[model samples]
Target: MISHAKIPFVVFETEPENAQRARDWNFGIHWSVPLLQDLMPPELFAKLASTRVDPHRPVQPSETLRFLNGATGIEIGAAFIPHLYRVQRSKLRALLAEGIPIQYDKAISTISYTEDGSTVAAHFEDGTTVSGTILIGADGTRSKVRNLLLGEEKAALDRLEYAALWVQAKYTAEQVKYLRSGHPLFLACCHPLGYFGWLGTHSAPDQDVPEEWVMNCYISYKEPIAEQEKCKKWPNEGNLGEVKALAELCFAEPFKSAFGWLGDEQEVWYSPLTQWDPSLPEHQWDNHSGRVTLAGDAAHPMTYQRGQGANFAIKDSLELVNHIGSFLDSETKGRKEAVRVYEQETKERAGEEVRLSYQNTEMVHVWEKVLQSPIMKHGLNPTS
Candidate 1:
């Protein structure tokens, strides 16, 4: 429902993925079924829903990675990806249609706001500067804009003792049958062993060929992120020898079998989970003038628990889109208050979500605690 026409804003995307937007929906509005149901037309919603593989579930303790009953009736996640290139390209296309300019592969080094807080300048690594009346920091987790505004010490991330290696691979019919039996998407906890994991599939770009299913998998354990970083490995990149070995070693049978599907030499993506701890440095902001702010992970980074991280991001952008006009109208004194309200609401909502997700992350890794989690129990039932 968001129309870019509302504001003549240009998007600057910097990526480890190189400006790609992902073609797969990841999991799309299915994460928040009821809420999206209210927003999207029935037909459109149904179309997205049709892409959903019902009955995502959990792994039961077994020496071989056994899956549990997927009887729980709820969708756990959703995504709306249109290929990394296509998304930005489409945005560029839209911008072109409206005569808006966009640039890519531009590394932003710092952001500076003028004296009166009336205009902001983004200094790119290429020694180029772009000025605008307002700045929305959607640069992501290690956001330069955020650090420039809040100061690195204050905006620092609080790393959890857990890390995970996630990957997507082609699912075989036999594998799908076994996985679907327990739950298409579900988690299993190794408990005392300090490990946990989840597996699920989303509709793929080339699904038409063989109706392929992409297994989205995660395996995490209690390990200090700093310890891992000391090894010169960011969360997004890891050697299979470390995290992968941990998975096979900690998980039982069926769980082991599940993870066994991971590629051997082709190192999969891995990173330690982190949350934006508002309590740290009191979660203060530097952009007091309200002319600059942030959205998405740059605004309130948290776990993808129940898909809240992504949903919160969407909500943040939507809220700004709705209130942006206030900031555009120079005479509107309420713009400051509007930004405050947005940040305040986002913080409250996302803070609790971050905390709960941190707690949830812990539960996922612990064997005993996971068995008692509402998420595991309710099986992602929308109400739960």
Candidate 2:
């Protein structure tokens, strides 16, 4: 959106390389929020539509959707409800080359400024600094920038007892043939023993040699006791056996086979879900100061249950864009007012989304409950 607006901005990316490969994609979303479609311009929408995995894919995101049973391997609930789409982050990264100045390897250590809101500077761990009129922390959940801005080494997070087992492995020919195996979109299941799992697939231009795409599998469950006992778990410790054993507890049969499906080169990351307060009290963007602000996960770190983490960030840019025209009006206090309005509106809307996600995290853990929940029942029909 910034690129399309012809805005001149500098982005600091800690990752040396783009985390997304050519075929890799993520962010399965439904337009639960109303303002998204109209805010997107035609050209941008066209580009997104062109990337659909299949030509026959739905033109509009639907409110109706279905879930696969990990136990019986059968799909359940209403089909084609939530008009949804599987979007790749790489597509957006491709836009950055359009004159966006991104400084890689420049991780921000701390951000400081004068009390009077002048001379805002971002200090890097390597002793580098970037001074600007304003700073936006788009760093993500464990945002270092947000941590410094909020005056805490550890940003406040609500740790949910719902732990997840996430693993990325390569796909096989047979695996790929299972069209219903959950690819291009999301395939999910909730086990009666108290766990939910989802499968998503991705392909990149880099698949020339192996002709394989990447498969991501996640199993989330309420494990209050096990989760609270440790700060971190086996995934970080690189204990494959323990992680597999844990999955066995929440999955059954072929779904258990999904565990064995762990590719030889596994990049497993196990962790519990965490949330950030949407009240925006912890870090407020002052119109008078307007030196520091945050966007995306840094601002509202909700669970992926609603797929709003990325969507909200995109919506935030729209909010910023709405205020940009006036803010750039140098003759008046437009910029300050713009900051105030954007932050105000963003916080209110994001707060609601954060709260909803918290509820969704609970409902999804229980299959029967999610089936009747609005998420599984409602489709994003514009008319509705």
Compare the candidates by TM-score and give the number of the best one.
2
Estimate the overall C-alpha local distance difference test score of candidate 2: 0.63
Off by over 4 Å in 1: 1-5, 15-101, 171-173, 185-192, 207-213, 225-254, 279-281, 326-333, 371-384
lDDT at position 83, candidate 1: 14
- Name the weakest run of 10 consecutive residues (lDDT summed) in model 1: 79-88
Misplaced by over 4 Å in model 2 are 1-6, 17-25, 29-46, 49-64, 79-84, 114-119, 179-184, 204-211, 225-231, 235-254, 263-265, 280-288, 330-333, 377-384
Q: Candidate 1 residues 115-179, lDDT tens each?
A: 87578888888899999867888877777777887778777777777776766566566765665
Q: Cα deviation of 312 in candidate 2 (Å)?
A: 0.7
> What local lDDT does model 2 show for residue 238?
59
lDDT of 1: 0.57
